[model samples]
Target: MSRRAEHDVRDLVERARAGEARAVARLISLVEDASPLLREVMAALAPHTGNAQVVGITGSPGVGKSTSTNALVTQLRRAGKRVGVLAVDPSSPFSGGALLGDRVRMQDHALDAGVYIRSMASRGHLGGLAWSTPQALRVLDAAGCDVILVETVGVGQSEVEIAGLADTTMVLLAPGMGDGIQAAKAGILEIGDLYVVNKADRDGADQVRRDLRSMLALATGRDGAWKPPIIKTVAQTGEGVDEVVDKLAEHHAWLASSGELERRRTRRARGEIEAIAVTALREKWGDVHGRSELDTLAAAVAAGDADPYGAADELLAAFTD
Candidate 1:
C-alpha cells in the first residue's frame, strides 16, 4: 500500500478505537469486500481486540431471535454498556446483498450512540453465518463494544456453527415451534450455553420448558461443567430479558473462573488461522494459468488414470515446487 493508504488505515483504526461508528463500519466493509488493505487493517486492529463478549443468538425461523437480541441490547445499554450487533441475514440471490431485515427490526437503537448495528449477508455461505463474520467481529471488538451480539440467519440445523465462534451461544425457541424435539434433532442441545424459551406468554410454553429440561437431563457432562439455563421470555414486551442478561453475566464469570475463556478463545483463534491458511492455499491453486494443477489432477483421477491420494500428492508437490 502507498503511504497515503497506510496513513488512512492508521487514522481509521484510531477513530474506531475512539468509538467512531463510521470508522468501525468502514473497517468491517473492508473485511466483507476482501479489500487489499485487509491485512493492514487487521494488523492495526489486532492490539485492540479480544475484549468484547461475543454472544451468538441462533434458532429456527420465527423463534424471535431478532426481538430477543433487541431486548438484550436494551438491557445491556440500560446498564451503561456499549453494544454492537451483527445480524447475518440470508443473501438475496438477485442482488447478493443483505435484505437488511434485521436492521429494520432493530431501529430502536438506531439513534443510540452507545450502540452500533450492522447487517451482513450470508452470501450463500452455510452454517448460518457469513464467511467474513469472525473478521467483522474483530472490527467490533476493536471498536470498544462492551458486548457484541451476533444474531445469525435463522437456518435451523446448520446454525450450530455459531457455538464455535461465540463466547456464549444462546439458542432461542418459542412455544408451538416444535422446538423441544427440533432442538434435539438439530444438535443445539449440545452447543447451547443458554437456552431461551421465548414468547412465553403463549400456551404450551411450560410444556416446552419441561420437555427441554427432561432432554437436557439425559445428556452427560463432565463434573462441574456449567449447566445451561433455560430462561423464559416474551421478547416483544421486554419481559424476562433482565434475567437472561443476568444469566449471561454468570456464564461469563464461570467461563473466566474455570479458565474456559482462555481455552475457548485459543480454539477460536486456531480456527481463524486454519480458515485463513486454507483460503490462501485455494487462492494460490486458482492462480495457475488456463487449466490449474488441481483441475489436471482432478481430470486424471476421474479418468482412473491416477488414484485420488496419488493425485493429491502431486498437487501438493506442485505447490511446494
Candidate 2:
C-alpha cells in the first residue's frame, strides 16, 4: 500500500468509471497477470460491480460462437445498452497470448464506443475459460456495461465452466454438430438457460430444433423451474437475432421474479472466493515444496510408516501453521 501505488490505482479506477476503454483494459490486464496490487484494484472497483447482466455462450467448436456473440452485441446496442465482451481463446504455446481470432470476427463493433471487447487466452486452463475470467468480469461490471457476453473456448464436453460464471448461459448448436443428442452427451443440456440453434438457414435445422426439444423434455429440472427456451438464428445476416434477444430479456425477467438472479450471483461469488483461496494455498505449497518437506513426506509414505491422508494433513499443516 505505498502512497504512489495507491494513488495510481485510485486514478485508474476513476478513469475506468468514467468509461475510458484504456483504463478498463489496463485493469483487466492486471487481473489476468495476477498483479501484486490486485487486492487494491478489486477493493476500489467493488462498489461499482454487480450491475451488469452477464450472459455466457458456449458449445462445440465451429458452432459459430463468435458470430452469435457479435450479433447479440449488435442487438443489445440497438436497444441503447452498453455491451462488454470477453472472448476466451486458446493460448499460444510460445507467446502465451490469445489467438485474437475471435476479436477479429467481432470487428463490426471496433468503432462503437458503447461496446468494449477483449480477447483472453485460456493459458492451458481447462473448462474452456481463462482463469482470470471472473475478475475480468468484475472490472467490466464496474465499468457500467449494461450487458457482458462471455464466449468460451468451446473445448467440447468440459465447456460447462461458463455456467458457473454467467447469469444466463446460452448453449449454441449447429445442425451438423452431431445433432442435439450429442449436445446432451456433451453436458451442455444441464447448464444452459437458453439454447440457440445457429445457421438456421441450413438444411436439417428443423431436425436440430426437434432433437433439442426432445432432449430437453427428457431432462428433468428443479420443481416449478424455468424451462430453457430454444431459439433459431442466422447470425451472419442477423435474421432471427432479435427474437433471441427477446428471449434473453424474457429469461432475465424470470430470473428476477424467481429470485434466481440473486442466487446465481451468490453462487458465482462463492466460486470466485474459493478459487482465490485455493490459488493462495497452491502458492504456499509451492514454497513448502522448495523446502523438500513434500519429498520427506513421500519417503515416509513409501516406507508405509505414514499413510497418504496423514501425510497430506502434515503438508497442509506446514502452511496453516
Candidate 3:
C-alpha cells in the first residue's frame, strides 16, 4: 500500500469510530480498491469484528428487500443498537459500477450516528460477491456497530455467498411468489435461517403466510435443528420492523448459547484469512511478473497463437513454483 493510503486508512478508521460520517464513507471507498493498507487496518481491527449480528436479507426482485432493510435498521437504532447495512446493488454490466438504487432508499441513515449503509457491486455478476467486499465488512464491524444487515443482489433466490458470510440469513418473498413448497427448491431453501413475507399489506398476504408455514413445517421434518421462523412485514409502513429485529436478536442469542456463534466466527475468520492470502499473492504476482507479460499472453491468445488454458497454466506455474 502507498504510505498515503496507509495513513489515511488508519486515520479514517479512528475518525469513523469517533462518529465522523464523511470519514467513514471515504474509508469504505478506499478499502474497495483492495490496497495493502486495507489488509493491515482490518487485521488490527479483526478483534472487534465478531461482536456484531451479521444479518443477510435476500429475496426475489421488487419484493421490498431494500425497504425492509431500511425499516430493520431504523428499528434496531430505536432499540439502541448501532447498525451498519451493506446493500449489494447490481453493477452496470457495461460500466462496471453499482447502480445504487438501493442506497438511495437508505439515505435517511446518512447522518445518523448509529447507522452506516454502503452498496457493494457483486464482484462477478450472476456468480457471487467480490473477494475484497467481505473484508470491508470487517472494517464496519470494527467500527463498533452492534448490528450489520446485508442485502444480496438477487430476485427470490437465497444469496448463498451472503448466507455463508452472515450470522443469520433471511429470505424475503412477496405474496405472489408461489404456494407449492417445491417452489423453494434450487439452492434457496438450504440457506435461509428465516423467511420474511414482505409487503404483507398486499393482496394474498394470508395465502402467502399459510403457504410459508406449511413449507416450514415440512422443512422442520428434514434436517436443521433450528426451525427458521416466518414473519410478515409491510416494510413501507415499518409495521413489523421491531418484530424482525427481535427475531434477529433471538437467533443471534440462540447461536451464542448453542456454541454455533464460535463456529460461525471461525468460518468467517478462515474466509478472511484466505482472502488476504489470495490478495497478497495477486499483488506479488503483478509486481514481480508485471502486466507486460500478461499483455503479451493476451495478444497471443487473441491471435490464436496460444491456447487460453495453456496461458493460464503458465501463470499458475509462477505461483505454484
Candidate 4:
C-alpha cells in the first residue's frame, strides 16, 4: 500500500521462485490494492510479466472444472513447467466467505514446488471473477511460473471476462448439457480461443462435439479465421488431457505467426485498464459522496427531482475533475 512496502514486495517476488511462500503471499496482497503504489509496482514488474502462457478455463458447473484443472496441472508438470492456478469462486453474499473452498478440491498440489494454487473469492462482485484477478495473475506471471491457469467461477459475464483475460480461453462443457449450450449464448461461444468438451466419457459426448464444431463452422471470424479446435477430455481419467494442452500450444503458435498475438495482447491490456479505471471511479465516487450524498440522490429520485441516468451523469461529471 505504500512505496517502501511495494519495493519490499518486489524483492520478495524475486525470491518467490526459491520457494518463499511468504514473499508470494505478500506480492499477491500488494497487487490487490488500488493505490498508486500498486500501479507503480505493477509497472516495475511488467518487464518480467507476460512470460507465462495464461490459460483461462470456464464452463458449466457440472463440467468437471476441478478435475480438468488437476489433469491439466499434471500434464504441465510432466512437461517440467512451473504452474500457478488462480481458482476463482464466489463468496457468500452474507458472510463474504467463499462458499466452495477451492483448496479442498485441489489438495494434490499443496506440497508441489512446481505447482502453486491460490483461491480467490468474488466477494460479491457481479463479474463472477474476483476484482483483483488481473493483478493477481500478473503477480503469478512475474513469479517465474511458466504456465498459469486461471479457472473462472462458473457464471455468466464473469466467465466471458475471464476468457478475455487469457491468452487462450478454453470453455469446458459437459456432454448432453443443454444448460451448457444456454450458457454459451452469453458470448462464451464466441470468446473461446479454444474449446474443451470435458467429461467426454459420458453419453452424448459426440453430439456436444458435433454441435460445437457445427456452430464454429458456421461462424466467420474477424478475418475468416480457422475454426478453433474442440478437444474432448475425460479429466477424471486423464484421457485426452495432453491433446488439450497440445491444442493450446497450437493456438499460441498460430497467434505468433498470424500477427494476432500483439493485437490480442493490446486488446487485453486495454480491457484490464478499463476494468481498473471503472473500479477506481466507483471507489472514488463512493468515498467522495458518502452515504449522505447517496441518500440525497435517492430522495431526489423519489421526489422526481433527478432521474437515475442524470444522477449517474452527475457522478461522471465529478470524475472529470
| True-structure RMSD, every candidate | 2.4, 2.7, 3.7, 3.0
Model 2 scores worst on lDDT over the 10 consecutive residues at: 122-131
lDDT of candidate 2 over 185-223, digit per residue (tens) = 788888888999999999988899998898889888852
Q: Write the per-residue lDDT of candidate 3 for residues 8-106, one digit (tens) a residue.
A: 767877887676767766666656654446656775666666778888777767778878888888888889998888776543434466656534667
Tens-digit lDDT track of model 1 for 203-249: 98999899989988888753258999999999999999999999988
Q: For candidate 3, what is the lDDT?
A: 0.72
As a TM-score, model 1 comes out at 0.92
Better of 1 and 4 by lDDT: 1
Q: Please, what is the TM-score per model?
A: 0.92, 0.91, 0.83, 0.87
Q: What do the candidate models score in CA lDDT, each in turn? A: 0.82, 0.82, 0.72, 0.74
TM-score of 2: 0.91
Model 4 RMSD in angstroms: 3.0
lDDT of 4 by residue, 1-321 (tens): 766877665676578646576676666655433434666667766877777888998877788888899999999888898999988654344554655564576787777878878777655443224346777788788778888899865443377667767888888888766844574565678878878888888898988888888787777774356468888889999999999878877887887778777777787888777777777666676656445454566689999999999887776676575
Clashes of each: 0, 0, 4, 0
Question: Candidate 2, overall lDDT?
Answer: 0.82
